[model samples]
Target chain A: MSRVGVVAIRRGIRVSIYLPIAELSVNMIILLAMGGAVGFLSGMFGVGGGFLITPLLIFYNIPPAVAVATGANQVIASSFSGALAHFKRGTVDIKLGMVLLAGGVAGSSVGVYVFALLRALGQLDLIVSLLYVVFLGTIGALMMWESIGALRKAGKGGSTTLKKPGQHNWVHRLPLKVRFRASKLFVSVIPVLGLGAFIGFLASIMGVGGGFIMVPAMIYLLKVPTNVVIGTSLFQIVFVAAFTTIVHASTNQTVDVVLAFLLMLGGVAGAQYGAKVGQRLRGEQLRALLAGLVLIVAIRLAVDLFVRPADVYSLAPGVL
Target chain B: MKRCARKHALAVIGMLLAVAVGGPSAFAQDQGEPPRETINIGLSTEVVAITPDFSGADLTIFGSLENPDPQILRQGRYDIIVVLEGPLRPVVVRRKDRIFGLWINVDSETFSSVPVSYSVAMTRAPQDITDAKSYKQLSLGIDNIHLRPAGENADPSKTEEFGLALRSLKQRSGLYNERVGSLTFIGSNLFRASLALPANVPVGTHRARAFLFRNGSFIDEASDQLMIVKSGTEASIYRAANTYGFFYGVFAVILAVITGWIGRIVFKRD
Candidate 1:
């Protein structure tokens, strides 16, 4: 009953028991265990752990940045676990993942540079928040919008209807000929790279691994099958995030290994269970729910932007 | 794993999805007890300045902080600061939002029950003295921290939105890191100035002050100006925007549509 939507609480105000996690207290253990639990969710659903963990951190009165950063650290481990499992299964498309990761790295570099530029300009936070709000909201609405349409169609006894293949356009005609044996398709690597770079830009800018976007891109742009797409994207995300974590850690020690380990422990187990449970839902139902969850997060972020923060210093934990 | 997941994903998703959309449970902690401690904010600095030739000269700022408080601090209200060093004037800059809908790359918020936070509020807002309006003014700055994608801007899209009311500056409000630093407009041909130290600036130097406050007290400001920064060098900042989420979501849905289409059209594979 404790606020079903953890991220829904307004930030900017102090609200909680004010229990600080000591250097190494039960709080730390809880944080680590919770992080792992969130990590499991990320693996099972292949979504960013922040979607779950950051809010949990906030619930404990942890600053949003720390929550987000810690969750990101945890993501490294969870993604690695998922990738390893997928690789063992031979479902991962290593070559494709590499191309996407290349784009992601390049994009992240640019995104980080831009982030610095904006900070120098003094508008980094607002832009990021606003963009997050708008982007997430629209995506959520689009997904929900489409899913509702599906539900309506289904209600009318026409749920399984399919539309014709739209125009292929230039995406298919580019020079490089690449093949995906699992999906039985041979296409240009250009689209893959372009998509990867584009998504990578977002990943770098946002500091997320870009799995939320990567999974879908593999399925649509590169035309991989649904089941394998998640596996393949995980393969790419694992390396990308792990490398990013290491780089960030080596550079700033931002990649909290302890945090990552905690998150991963929970994530691996949660994923196994989530996968088990996910098998029962219809595809649309799952999509609708996931989309809804995503939308809720996006809206909260957007609201945080324009609305007066419930309390200021939303990002300040130690500083505040 | 795949076999196991495929077999169970449906059930798991079904249960979660049902609960997710079913509406919030009424008594689920509408709001919780407030944090029980006073957080002492120690920072290096809160603001920075833009390099010359940047439409004139712009600035960015951030406040690094720490909790001197001994007890566990929840994330909440604490004042941050930004007193312009000089160039004193109002500035306008775009503060872009990701739009208020479900987006692709940007992260969607999630709920959790973790216990690691120090809730507090920053008491200082960035401001500049305005001789024209006869009062102090301040506004959000460029980028959440003076950083952005290439070819994009940190300025506001509207003129009126960029202008700050003295009363608003006088009255403190809530803020999030996402929208911090993005200024609306910083005058044409940029001017230079120093910012006044807001009363409660945490006991640390700022990274870039002029970069954050702009020309004097003409613009509304967030207190990131007084952050710890290397002197005279352009400070680099970044956001956690998650662009991949956008593309991934976009492409994933598109693929779902396409596959469903092709499943029916090509081989009736659906």
Candidate 2:
């Protein structure tokens, strides 16, 4: 059961939970509900909940700056748990994850600087929202289309062959080749590093763990085994999120620990329950559901961009 | 929790009672002195401590309209406007313009000094109480608040519209409020108003100003101060997060890791 009894009401229609960095009180129930919903989806789909949580936080009237930074803080917890589970299963490629982590940390630093510049220019909200619409829209559509194709293939009783990774791909032709025994792939470290850096850049600016993006990129592009992709992505995400948290905390002062803690209270439990529920669903069905959810969020964001806002002007503290 | 909240309420009431009983006699003691314009005010609490359990507070402002001429009192032409204004801070107001079929922030205005929260209670509607010139001079209403832009680039004439937009936004957020005839009279000379400080009220020293008007003319104004501060664990955490950000971030990471580990143990699956 949810800890509904813990909620303390301030006034009519308000159950306030003070966010330290945001320096405001938000509805406790709403924050927890959002966290739980995203956490459940993360556990069921093996995607970091940040992609959903950050957008939902924005919808709840949290400042985009605060939402992105604090979302990174919260992702640390979820990714840590997910990573540990994969570690215990012996699916995590620790060396590859470390290399990705190194690249991710460097990339996040540059991303944080870029985020600061956009914020200074008062374009952070526009950029973040636009990024969400483009990336989420493209990724969701692709996932849905691919999963539908797989489902159709299964329906026709045809055997599907995954083209052997690293065989004739441009990724293998690059210099500085390294062998990863766990995924049984021999690939250039340059592409892996470049991929990690790109995902890290997106993760920092978009307030997502970049797991959904990273998982697909690793499997199809880097040719990492399906079993190892989730674990390695989680491993890299943990460090990237932690690094992003510190950078944001030190620079932007937007990491609201109080809010993050409250979110985790619901997220941790919801993830466990969701994992249990996930055991009953097939892989294609899970992918379909996740893709549908992503598309829905993307469309919602797109509609917001097109629709006229009731108030054309907004106020944030401090001079531009 | 119920008992704790009641205790706080009782404490506030006791303070108000002390002020009510002790205030008049002190001022009346100087009987031979010439009468002068004076306003005496007392708050239910001078300081609001926002601990982790603090949701918000309903603050009471009680005061007396002292030394008004007996003739004016008899004429019953006095109006009172009580305003509580939060600390001034810079604010950015952005306007979205349609660009290529999508709304984007094309124009922006920055106000160097604007109250984070402002609430006003008047004895009657502002328009009925005074003329527009006096209202602007006194900043009596939400629309009349003078929030000037930081830089001179913004056109002066467009500021009114921008100010109105800011007011609407703040009003929707429950940070700005205006109430007509909300103040009640305890007697002919004493009046009190209660303001509900929303949970999101900006933490700072707030000014509670009361203005007196008679026959559509400004009479006298008195102002008092109230401080809202974070206390207990909330304060400590907030302090750490701001003062020692990098360490706090690391601590946050450790906390998350520990919680995640414990969650894994508790929810262990074969």
Candidate 3:
């Protein structure tokens, strides 16, 4: 009876075990126990469930795509609950999160719509495949360059330039100004609208969280100090993803509780230690490694476009 | 006594069962209710059998969509049945990268209909099939194929069949007796092949199996096997699809901020 329970839960399958002495399966029991450990890690750090968890899901025989969706569902809930806890501690940058959220929501809605469009045209994979190559390739290249620069100036560290928009750019000249006291700046709200929408759209289309895009944009584009970017970004993602989850659920019905919980279970815990470990390692090395990985993936995706490996071609209309 | 080890193992198993299975319910109170929904063409309602149609050759087998799912799969899970025509065609595989990403497919770029796996094979023997291209246009044509609606009539002894199409390096596939042995071959040498709809494809077969043809005869045949284990496979794929951009993005950004924060901590010496 006990073994049965372990197998069921570890697989994230909601199976009832009322047998007095239910026989346990070795695989299932360890898997569920692992979920708990991962969840703990998520609490320590500040991340959604999918990034680290889904891959693990595959380890237990879950399909990659299913693993990914399930992880998303779990991350949505964990983020909501965790964000609330963080809110109580006043660690979250609500104001900043809100701006990003506003844009993220807009972008995500449009992103979903765009996805629908691609689906309709039956060329969604084509677009997604294209965007992934372009986006990952560009970001990977930029990350590699920065990491190299950082490594060259390792001991002679100065400071990253907090670049703002050009004087003639419309963003700086916009009328309404938004201020983040912690970040210590007064920037135009217009940029947030445009930026959030862009990231949000990308997030939706690519099934990505938009943090990779957001963090960099905040630091370089708006010149938001690096100190507050992560926390603020998390705060924003909590809402944006939650909204996306709801939208996907109601509109697309793409949320999987079991998958999410399993991944979240691991990610939350992994994040805590990962944060600790991440702190110890060379940021440059991690960045370089990450860049290399993304570039490799990008090259593969780009070649796929010309080769046209995608099998389906029936087209349809999409919605936002 | 050997009984001692068995007892010890049982005890450990009991302890694990409580922890592993009970773990979910432990937080069941904490979790939200499961959301229920469906996609356009969802469910793998048949066991697609890929026979040795292309028997000894590195022939690329093609499939047609049976049940269409309007909503795309978030957790993409579909098994392939590599049914070949009687005898396979001349095969050359290549891996190349275009604007998209790395595609495992045939060497040709423009006329590349489907991305195919790059594996070399001979009629009498399946050689070390490596360094080949992935299938470019060898998959089914439909995305999000819809299954039976939620409230459709249930027939106890009814099966359904969807249309089938076969494409290869040639336009028309036919039986070639001279080359290696009695086998099927695509007629046209132009590059790609499309759909071959069969008139006698059984009606209402739930999910049926039919041969994939090129010109006028049977070459390769396949079908989909329904595996509705629990009815949540659709949601499984949908949920995890849109997570990467947000979550990892956050991790990357936060780490950068932490770096700056630590920089401040260390730079205090200056």
Top DockQ model: 2
Weakest 10 consecutive residues, lDDT, candidate 3 chain B?
B123-132
- State in Å the error of residue A105, model 1: 1.7
**Model 3, C-alpha of A120: deviation from truth (Å):** 2.5
> Best-fitting candidate, measured by TM-score?
2
Q: Is candidate 1 or candidate 2 better by TM-score?
A: 2
Residue-level error in angstroms, candidate 3, position B18: 63
Per residue, candidate 2 scores C-alpha lDDT tens digits across B105-224 of 877778888998888888888877789999888877788888888886878867766777888988877679887888766765788977767556778999999988877788788999
lDDT of 2 at B263: 72
lDDT of 3 by residue, B60-158 (tens): 223332221112111122122222222112222222334334342222211112211112111111111111121213322221111121124533222
Instruction: Compute the interface RMSD for candidate 3.
Output: 16.0
Report residue A55 deviation for candidate 2 (angstroms): 2.2
All candidates: TM-score: 0.48, 0.86, 0.47
Q: Would you give the TM-score of chain B in model 1?
A: 0.18
Docking quality tier of model 3: incorrect
- Displacement of the residue B93 alpha carbon in candidate 2, Å: 0.9
Error of 2 at B91 (Å): 0.8
